[model samples]
Target chain A: MIDTIGFDGDDTLWHNESLFSMTQERFRALLAHAADPDDLDRRLLDAERANLKVYGYGIKGFVLSMIESAISVTDGRVPARDLQSLIDFGKAMLEHPVELLPDIADVVEALSHRYRLILITKGDLFDQESKIARSGLAGRFDAVEIVSEKDSASYRRVLERHSVAPDRFVMVGNSVRSDILPVLAIGGHAVHIPYAITWAHEEAEPPDEHYRRIDSVLDLPPLLAAW
Target chain B: MIDTIGFDGDDTLWHNESLFSMTQERFRALLAHAADPDDLDRRLLDAERANLKVYGYGIKGFVLSMIESAISVTDGRVPARDLQSLIDFGKAMLEHPVELLPDIADVVEALSHRYRLILITKGDLFDQESKIARSGLAGRFDAVEIVSEKDSASYRRVLERHSVAPDRFVMVGNSVRSDILPVLAIGGHAVHIPYAITWAHEEAEPPDEHYRRIDSVLDLPPLLAAW
Candidate 1:
């Protein structure tokens, strides 16, 4: 019997990557003269991947990487004005209001009454905290963890801190790389709820038979009930 | 009665503000042609204060504010190269090695064996985590909290989560605004160990007769013993 449920914040509960996608479009347009669209995307991703250890994940890092990529792809010719636009993009993304996925509010509220709900996310500390506050679902969570990354060790640490045994916990998230695989590795059950958009870095292969997958968080209640 | 002790990172455990001070010197040199030193400092601080809500605290936010300030101070004519250099400044600060304050490692290690030690510092999560790991004192900390801000409310929440009462808790750190006042506000004991350099934003008038003021964390063990 699972007494605790871990929920991923970004694409799992609300609209997140979509904001990044929209900004990337703006970013590409701002630097259209410097590089081709596909090339720009590749360079931006490469910069993000390279800087992950240094900058970590978040709008701040994304904006920094975009600025860095713009300079590299343009051979230092990208205008300071364009770089300012990238900074503005970060500000807008950080201020963007949180939008909950379909029926997620009701689902979370119902589940919160039964299980200890933890909203686990990976990103800039301020960005994640603001989103949680704006999500209007903050009251439902018994705990909130804004980690820098999600892996087996991170999962184990979080569980240990909460005094929850792995076998009695269930993680519900959108990214298989972050939410599903790591939890399963730690002997916790995970429910994969595919989101409409996934960041390239979060893409991963689906696990076979070990965990369940649902198209949306709306289906989570019935699935948990049956289990 | 104190069974738990919370230690602040940054300048309290290692060199932090000095790195920023050195980077600011480089930044000033980079934009020397555009503005006066005093004026530039004011502009950067203004930008930082304005962006604090959106950007929070960290090297990434600091770098972004620097770029913004440079553009404003230069009337949007700050060169792309200068902006790139600012980004490099952030990267360097993040990758910089951790230097524990004088006798901090031994002080923390000694305290850890007697009391539950929680490294509670506010800033970018990833950056703080890296600094903790590099400090070679991570094992001494029973818990680590990388919060966005340190306040009475945040302190109350952290202690409650750890099942520690404020009366039985003592926080040691460099900033009175962050480490001393807030913890004391929540009925907890706080030790203020002033760092040589304090960020302007972290400056506050010293409190009278409420908390202990030590020259350094080197003085911590003896003070606690007397208490």
Candidate 2:
């Protein structure tokens, strides 16, 4: 039996990437003069990749990269109001509501009694803590870890914290790279719940059959029961 | 004997408030026309107080509060470039070097084998984790927790995680509000290493006389040795 179940906060349980998408559209318009929408998008991704080490992931880093991209892409011709607008977009994203994906609440409620449920997310500490506080699912989680990145070492640490080995720990998340691959590599069980939108950085070709894949978190309960 | 030692990261182990001091000077110059430096400082503190529940601590929230303070103080007349400058100041603060406070490194190194050390700091997760990673102190800590806030409950949780009660736990830090009082309230031993500069928000009266105080963290090892 699975002793603990780990959930990814953004996109898996709630609408996260969609907010990033909405803000990216605003960004494309803000820099329309600097480059075409497609070109601007590519450049922004490039900036994010380069700044990842310096800023890490989350809204603060994202906002910084947006500013850097805006200034560099426009050759420093971007208006001050436009700079403020980029900051505003990030502020709006941080303040955005945590919209739970269909049946997530129900699944969490149903699963709480049977398994130890924890939130293992990576991002800006403040943003993730704020989101978790506002997510209204706070009291339900047994543990919450806001980490810098999701990797093999992170999974191993999580397993140690939960006091369970790979076979006894299961993960449920939206990203193949973060939620599934690393957990499987550690010999833990994983389930992929497909989100409507995934961050480009989180996308990876699905690993060969060690874990289950379902249409939604809504279907997670029955699938776990069968296992 | 103290079985576990908890160290507050920012101002205690490394230079933190001084960076804020430097940034505040810049903020004052940027908004000099809006209000006097004293007035701006007061308003920013007010903004930080109001947004504490929303943004928490660390550079990101500090920067947001600074922006809000600027807009309100200037009657919305603050220049967009000035606003960008505020964001830039925060970015610079996060990127600031972790300058070790006088004898912190030696104290930690001396006490590592004798105590179960954990770095219990509250702030933006990425920034704190990155600082700890770069500070060359990670090897000394058995555990590192980047919390959203520090309170009686937080201290209690930390003790529980370390599998100890109040008498067996000891904490050392710079802030009366965050580092000292909370630990004392929970019946744990505390040491206050007074930093010359402190954020207005973290200012508070010394609560009773149960804990000890020293001029520098360098004094910590001898103090711990006696206790």
Candidate 3:
């Protein structure tokens, strides 16, 4: 039986990738004078992938990458006003309200009563804290950890700190790379609930037949009930 | 006697503010034709102050603010190449090597043998982790905490999570606002080693007589010995 459960904060609990998608649309339009939408999208993705090491993850990095890509694609011809608009885009995203996934609140509420819930998210500490506070779901989780990366080592570290054995812990999230395989590698159960939108960087190969899969977090309680 | 000790990461343990100072100098020189040095500095500070809420703290936010300030100061006439330079400045800072303060390594080593050492820093989680790992002092600390803010409540929460009592804990750092005041307010001991450079936002009134003050971490050993 799972005594402790971990939840991914971004797409799992609330709308996150949609914000990036919408902003990417704005970003592409802003630079349309210099590059086509397809070209701009490819360039932006390249910048993000290249910058993930130095900038890590979050809206701040995304904005910086956008500016970098705009300059490179435009051959340093991107206007300063356009750059300013990019910065404004980042601010708007940071201030955007948190929107919960379908029935996630009720799912989390029901699960909280049965297991020790931890909000394990990987991103900018300040941004993640802001979202958790605004989500109105902060009180449900026993602990919230905003980490730089979600990997086997990080998962092990967090689990050890929380005095949770891998055997008794289960992770639930959207990204297979971050939420599923790492936990499974560490001997913990993982519940895969794929979101409609997935960032390219977060994409991973399918996990072996070891972990459970669900259509939505709404289906989580019943799945666990059977366990 | 202090059984557990916490150390702040940035200026207390390494050279941090100097980086910002150097970058600000370059920024002013780059925008010399647009605004006077004094005016540019003031504008940049204002932008940073205004952006703290949305952007939080880190090189990423600082870069965004610099771009904002550059555009505002230049009245949107700042060249695209210059804006690209600003983005490059941030990437350079993020990749810059960690420079430890005078004898901080030795000081941490000495204290680690006697007390449980915790490196409690407030900043971007990824940046802080990189600095800590690069500082070669991560192994010396029993635990590390990268938090969003350092206040009384944050201090209390950290202490409770570590199973530490306030009376037996002591926090050592450079910033009076972040490292000293909040720890004292939480009923714990604090040792203040003032850094040469202080950010305007971090400036707080003189802390009360309850806390200990030292000129450097070099002086920390003797001060703790007498206590």
Candidate 4:
């Protein structure tokens, strides 16, 4: 029987990618005259590749890059209007609201009765805490871990802390890199949930046979029931 | 001088949260008949809190939980038409397309001229790999790591393998938990780019520091020019 459940935060329990999509759509519209969608996308990807050195991850760097990309793609000919759009986009993203995924609460409620729940996520401390408080789900977890990254060592630490043997634990999330492999590496079971739009940075290739893949979270209960 | 740059994926470089928001709106609407918006949200939050154990993280488990929540909230009284709406919503989410943030490619191209670039993300292997292939940005990264998680040790390993020092390295991404803190923990610098909507599962508070908070990726050239 599974005694401990490990979870990933972003794109799992809440709305995250849609806002990014909206910003991109606006960006594309802004650059319509300067470059085609393909060309603009290519340039922006190049900028992200370059900026990763100076900016680690988060919206601040992304907005900056968007501005830089606009300027570069426009050959420094970016209109003041476009620049304002970029700034406005950044501000909008910063102030965007938080929303949870469907049925997360009820399903969690059902599972909580039988298992030890832990929230394993990696992000800014204040931002994350605020979201949890806003989510109003902070009280349900037995422990909440805010780490720099999720990997074998992080999993080991979590499992050890919970006194759970690898076999008795499960890791679930949308990304293969963070959710499945590390746990599998340490002999833990993992389930993969594919999202419609995955971020380029979060991209990973999955291996066959070490873990299970489900199309939606709804399938989990039946799968776990079988297990 | 910086020779190589690594990036954290997920919320950093694309539109991610909008889909969740749409689903959330749908969820709230669906439950509006049975409960108030605030109460429904509270219930969903409660379910998410509970499921963190059995499901962990990702859309599959979330989608499942959402279905469960719908069933429970409506006491299995949801109309057949509404059931179709729920199914359609999930289908739409699964079929949702992927798009990059504005100017992302442009910034990478500019930066690639002066530094080696790599992509480091954590998630399921197949999911990440598929995204990378579809993204068409794969060629830009010198190395792409779809890691299981990110932590100080993992960062150390990446740095060691690349023969780089923490001081000279910069990690960028939307996740402070995965991107900023670990780099700082290992003596590397990180830039935080806050996103509009962060996934509750990936949520973590920010550290108390000035160097840690950044307004945008565009701010990097100025900051790093001096560094």
Candidate 5:
């Protein structure tokens, strides 16, 4: 029996990827005057991959990558005003209101009675904390772990701290790379709830295994009940 | 007698503020073409205070503030090449090698046998982790807590988890605001080690208090040995 359920914060519980997409749209528009839109898009993604080694993920990292790519694609002529626009775009993202995914509250509320609900997210500590606190759902979770990254090792360590056996823990989230694969690797159960928009960096190949996938988080309760 | 000791990561144990100062100098240079240095400096400080409300502390927040101030000071004419320079400056700050403060290792070792040593730091998750892993001093601490912020309540919670009473705890660090005041307010002991270059934002009006303030971490051993 699953005694604990972990929820991924960003795209999984709320409309996070939408914010990133909106910002990316603004970034592409700002850099459009200097380079082909498709080329600029590709370069920005490449810069993100390179900067991830140095900057990690989240709005801070995303802003830096946008600035770096703008400079390179424009050969350092991207203009200060445009860079400022990018910075403003990022600030808006940081200040954006937390919007829960459809039926997330009802689903989480139903699951809470059967198993302990925990929030496992990785990002800027303050941003994630602010989002959770503002979500007004902070009191629902039994625990919250804001981490640097989520992998099998991180999941195992978290479960170990809760004195939970791997099989007794289940993770539910949007990203296969972050939410699904890691939990499954640790002998834990998982339900993949696909967000309407998933970050490209989080996409991964399908593993030769079985795990339940749902169109939204609202479907989570009935699946867990069956398990 | 203090039974558990906590060390603040950034300036207390290593050379952290120096990197920030160097980066600020570079930021000043990068924006010099578009605005008066003194005026730009004041504006940047203002931007930092404004952004702190939304970004919190850390190298990432600092970079965003720098970019925002650059845009505002230059009236959005800061130039993309200069913006790229700013991004590189931040990357340098993140990648800079960790340099231990004078006698930090020996001091922590002497105190460890007498009291449980813990590291409490707040900043970008990956950057802090990178510095700690490379510091080669990770094993000296009994535990590490990378938190969102260090406040009275945070200290109280951490102490409770460690099964420690606030009165039995002692925190040592460089900033009076972050390192000294809150811990003292929580009925815990604090030792303020004044770094040569404390960030202006971390400065607070001198409070009436009896907590010890040492010139350096090297001075901590003898002071603690007597206690």
Candidate 6:
């Protein structure tokens, strides 16, 4: 029986990818002289793939890649007149603020009674903490963790910290990687809540057994209530 | 002077609150005997306030609160027959899928060439990553961070990791707390991208000095280009 529940942040609880899409379109228009949107995307993807190790995950790295892609695709011909626009674009992205997924608070409130909840997240600590505080749901968690990465090891640590046995804990989130895969690796049950937009860097192979996929976080309470 | 950019996820990227509104309507129907929709909402909010420490952020917690509220409002007289429907509602939430904010990807690509791009996000790793991957903009970012929270410390780490000075960085998002306040705290610039539905959890005190606010992310490129 599941007694404790762990959740993923980002798309599971709020909106995320659409912002990137907006930025991507703007980038394509700026580079129209050098390449088509498809071509620009391919080049940008290539750059991101090459830089993942150095940049890790987040906007700082992506902005750099956009710069790098512009330089590479344009063969250094992207006019200086447009260079500041690129920088301005990066600045624009940085200034973007956060918004939550629909009905997230309502759902969280509904689920709190039955489960010992833990928020298992990965990212820069300061940013994570600020979001938690702002999220208003911060007060609901028994524990909140900010990790550099989400892997099998991380999942084990979280379970250990909560004294939760794999069979008694269920991981609920949107990613097949950080949420489903890692928990499953530790013999924990997992529920996959697929999101609309997925970051390339966070992509992983499909889930195996011990992992169940869902469309939203609201589904967990009923599943657990029965368990 | 900013050379890099970041974006917040959630309402900024898609349609979210409407789903919760829909679910609330359904839930109110189930508990029509207990209280009116507004009363139910108020009670749920009260319960949410009380349980924030136990459930943390997201739909899992909200659903729990809804269940709790249902039980409370009904004075524990919630019909057993209706219990199944409540559970089904929770399940339905889980099955609900993500739908991207309109024109998001194209805009991001358009802006990518003119700026250094990054996706600065806070939440569960899997959920955030899933949204990024599914959004088809996975290849666009130089970095993708699934942060635990958003605060000054998180922003500092992001800056340090990228070896970029705060003066050269800019933050973009829809939340005043996570995206705007923290960036400003660190002497970095920020732009407030407001969305239609702001999660109560992510809402913060209104605008103050040291920040700029905008109606949408679409206005960013032009605004920044002029900057």
TM-score of chain B, per candidate? 0.95, 0.92, 0.95, 0.81, 0.92, 0.85
lDDT comparison, 1 vs 4, better candidate: 1
State each model's C-alpha RMSD to the native: 1.8, 2.9, 1.7, 19.6, 2.5, 23.0
Residue by residue across B21-86, what tens digits does model 2's lDDT show? Answer: 899999999998879999998899898887676566778778877877887787666665677687
Model 1, span B1-227: residue lDDT tens? 88899999989999999999999999889989998889899899999999999999999999999989988888778778788999999999999988888988788888888999999999999888888899899999988988888989999989988999988999988888889988888889988888898555656655644479888677788888877
Question: Can you rank all candidates by DockQ, best first?
Answer: 3, 1, 5, 2, 6, 4
Docking quality (DockQ) for each candidate: 0.80, 0.42, 0.85, 0.02, 0.71, 0.03
The reply for model 6, stretches above 4 Å from the true place, is A1-227, B80-84, B198-210
Predicted candidate 1 versus true structure: per-residue lDDT over A14-85, tens digit per residue: 989899899999988888887889999999999999999899888999999999999899888777877888
Flag regions of model 5 displaced more than 4 Å: A198-210, B198-210
lDDT of 6 at A161: 54
lDDT of 5 at B150: 86
Query: Candidate 2 at residue B144, lDDT?
Result: 91
| Model 4 chain B worst lDDT run, 10 consecutive residues | B52-61
Q: What is the DockQ of candidate 4?
A: 0.02
Instruction: Estimate the TM-score of every prediction.
Output: 0.96, 0.89, 0.97, 0.48, 0.92, 0.50
Off by over 4 Å in 3: A198-210, B199-209
Q: What is candidate 6's lDDT per residue for B129-221, written digit by digit as tens?
A: 556666677677776666656889878977776677877777888778778888888888788887777666766654654467778677878
Which is better, 1 or 4, measured by DockQ? 1
Q: Mind giving the per-residue lDDT tens digits that candidate 5 earns over A1-227?
A: 77889999998888888898899888877776888778988998999999887887788888888888888888877777777778889989999999998888888888778789889998878889889998888888988888888999989988886788978888888888888888888888877887776555666545534378888676778778777
Docking class of 5: medium
Query: Per-residue alpha-carbon lDDT of model 3 for B1-227, expressed as tens digits?
Result: 77899999999999899999989999999999988999999999899999999988999999999999999998998888998899889889989999999999898999899999999999899899998999999999999998899999999999999999997888999888889888888789889888888556665555565588888788887877777
Q: Would you give the TM-score of chain B in model 2? A: 0.92
Candidate 5 has an lDDT of: 0.83
lDDT of each: 0.89, 0.82, 0.90, 0.69, 0.83, 0.70
Top model by TM-score, which number?
3
For candidate 4, write residues B54-160 as lDDT tens digits.
33344433454565566567765655345445545754654466667666767777777777777887643334544566667788887676554577887887777
